[model samples]
Target: MDGYTTALVCAAAAAGAALVRSGKRYIDNSAVELLAAPDGVRAMIEAHCPSLVAPARARLVPPPYLPTGMLQTIYGAMVALRRDSESDIEYDRQLRTMEDGGTVSLDWFPARPSGPECAQPIAIVMSGLGGSAYEYHIRCLAKHLATKSRAGMRVAVLNYRGSGRTPLTSSTMYNGYDTSDIYDTVGYLAQSFPRAPLVCVGFSMGANLLARYLGETGDKSRIAACVTVSCPFSGETAGRAINAPGLLFDKFFQPALTGTIKRIVKRNQDIIQSGAITYDIDAIMRAKRVCDVDNALTARAYGFKDCWEYYAACSSTDFIERIRCPFLAINALDDPIALPEGLPMDQIAKNPRAAIALVAHGGHIGFFSGLSARMWHLQPVLEFLDAVLADKAE
Candidate 1:
């Protein structure tokens, strides 16, 4: 009834909120299961992710004394922010010419040329939604591949059309499920370095595209292996998760989408004026939800009937079973964008060449651990790649 009592009540409420947000169950190693695989791939899975093997439970221990799940996710982002600016890795930038009268930027970090001709495999890295080649995760992976002593591989990060200062010569922009750009990029890489084994690594939306591409091409794919981290298996679930009330995902994404739409609109002003396509630029820019943006801009540009249609066509859930290559798909239980419900766990469990790693708490792409904030997922990824390459050699 008095000021002191009111203040006390408010403090108690805040404490309760904190406790609720911080509370997350640790995943026991016994609960994790490796997807079904054939003899050789199964052996590789056991070697790399033993936790997935039956009776060999492996636990994902969060940093000692730190908050779990959501808190860890936020903390990892903060750590990445601090370290992302200090990257010194240089890239040779090139404009990859596309068949559709468009171009996308590629940042190439080649391995030491003097070592051996095509001795190292080439990794094509794809960035998350609204992400560029210089994104922290992309840069980290590129640097890791380039600097690893045993597997010093060349890295190429693809910047989606109209992203990262890449001009949009055509009116069309990339959507979540589009695989045309990836197809073109891989074609170019295969032709340019005929002797090098190619590997594809994608994060978030890039992962979605990569998964779809793998399923579409199946045994015809030229790449030796593929890895998808934080893929949104179901576009509907991913859209709902990002747009959920009180979450920061939409807040973080909307501004970037607005800017990208604006850039595309400005670049293709002549096309708009000539009535070649219809897009409510103002509505697209003002979109508060990711689905709305996709409907207004992405779907229209790509000729989808609507956002829902676009999401369905782009969702990997429909095609994950068709994936025929050595593949590793990783998703965190607490990832805000890629909800657990979106993953086709049962389907993956049945696929011999595909394995899914469902961690207890690696929020989206924020898989930070220990004092140095190193990405913990990279170890398994590198290990898996090594196993795949070794299997190929045999």
Candidate 2:
């Protein structure tokens, strides 16, 4: 089947899955509907994470024009764009130079005064595509996890090279395919806090990267547990879904993403001009779609023959089954960007170490619920992390 047809089938299947559940709500007023197979992971979640089993119901008020999945996805992004940063949350920046001379910024949120220090649980936050510490979701997750009354966890945000105002020292820039930077960062965290039970939470593109990292590292992974939100499991399906005609989801996202890519390029234009990174600079700057930029730049930079090759090779779908660490993937079936067709449901079900929470509606990273329109996904995340930490402690 063609890409578009495949995406439609996936969407239909997701819709069918949502309806097949027993007519029961876990919690009053909760819009979240969990679709997970019966497994040890699910049992752990049920036993430890009570909030997820019976979360308080919250209302989602989507604007008039933003009704369907396509528009809801855009609306989700718009919400993130409009949110103001938390004033009370601050960071202590630590710049670490990678082996290749590229630099990544690890923004560590201040330690909790009331929380344990000697063996405090550590949570790392990874940003989405073109994301930084400035992104609302990243800040929200970091702050939420670090709350003394809540998780009381030590939190850090990993900003890729050239992101979070980190200078790009090497010719190579960051891409979803390469997990070396994450490998380096994780190594640093493991070494610095040897006794801490390390956990990671990644959103969108970062989620995909985290999944790939977990799968690749397998049993060697130092991370005790992980949660990925809105990950694009199959890049091929996701690319096709976003670029699908008539949906206009691509029309909304492509230009915006390309703009971000262009700005990043321009910031490190000197490195590109040095003839080190072999790509058509003008073509990249003129990219009208996300695919265009990927074809012109990302695919080449990563040594892939083309973007399609890169998409297939880098997609986390192939790696999900190999993941050894306890992992949870949180997704919205209606997310226009991360199409449900790509979710490795079969693989996840087979992997005893993995579980998935497929909500009927959460839009990419925008799981906004409640009358106040706050991020509702944070609750499940906190519950999951808290559960993992507790299980480890015992």
The number of the candidate with the highest TM-score is: 2
lDDT for each candidate structure: 0.73, 0.77
Residues 1-394 of candidate 1 have per-residue lDDT tens digits of: 8999999999999999877665434334214445555653666788755544545344455565433556665664454434453345778888877886777988888532333256578888897877777666777777776676255578888888878678776666766867999989889777777777889899988999998898899888998988898899899888777666664554555555556566666676665445467778778667777777787877887688888888777788877788888889877787877888889988786778888877776777876655555666676677677678777767
Model 2 residue runs over 4 Å out of place are 1-31, 35-37, 55-67, 81-88, 111-117, 148-151, 273-277
**Which pairs clash inside model 1?**
none
RMSD of 2: 9.6
* Worst lDDT 10-window in candidate 1: 24-33
Write the residue-wise lDDT of candidate 2 on 306-390 in tens digits. 7788888779998988998778888878788798888999988888778887666567887765445567677778888888788
Clashes of each: 0, 2
